[model samples]
Target: LVVFLFKQALTWIFGLLVVEKNLISYPYRLFFKKANKANFSFEYFIYPGLCALFSLYYPKNKSNLLKTLHFFISTSVIVIFEIIAVKYTKLIKYKKWTWYWSFITIWITDYVTHAFHKWFFKTKFHE
Candidate 1:
């Protein structure tokens, strides 16, 4: 639950920013009909779940380069999927957003969340 909450917190923060600023949007979603096209459900659940999974499986003791590579690959795949979705589906519509913006944001989000996860667990467990 903590993992889910942590990721959702980050998601809400970043997700609200882009949506409220009109940088990106989701015209179709399962819930939150009044938040414009922000897709708050995705931010609050699906994405946070995925990010929590990433954190849970992350190799906390690995070298920095390997960890960086993992983040790059994970975020790049997401960006590629976003590009394909943008081309083939109505899942997301970018106003001033681009692929790089998604990549950067995803990377930073993962990095920040995972770093916190590591520190939190390190201090609280196996001591």
Candidate 2:
């Protein structure tokens, strides 16, 4: 839940900036059509849920190479699907954005959230 919320907060800020900058758009949002330009569903729910999964399943004891591979594969899957959505769907549109932006942002956010998760659960306390 911590990871999910962290991702959600990051997305809310960055996603709004991307939309406000005309870098990307969502033509078919389920909510927040007037209050914001970003895709609420994706930024608020979908991406955060995915981040939770990423943090939960992350291999903490793995080698550096394996950890890097995990990040690469997870980020690549989202970028590949996003490319397809851009090509065939009206869910997301790229104005000044590209697949690399999504890839980089996702990778960075996931890395940050993973680091947060580690620091968060690193020690136990009782009151």
Cα-based TM-score, every candidate: 0.87, 0.94
lDDT of each: 0.82, 0.91
**What TM-score does model 2 achieve against the real structure?**
0.94
Residue-by-residue lDDT tens digits, candidate 2, 1-127: 9999989999999998999999998998889789999999888998999889988888879999989998999999889999999999999999999999899999999999898888898887667
On residues 32-72, what C-alpha lDDT tens digit does candidate 1 reach at each position?
A: 67755577767787778878878877766899898778788
Top candidate (TM-score) = 2
Question: Stretches of candidate 2 above 4 Å error?
Answer: 124-127
Residue pairs in candidate 1 whose N, alpha carbon or C atoms collide under 3 angstroms: none
Q: How close to the true structure is residue 87 of candidate 2, measured as C-alpha lDDT? A: 95
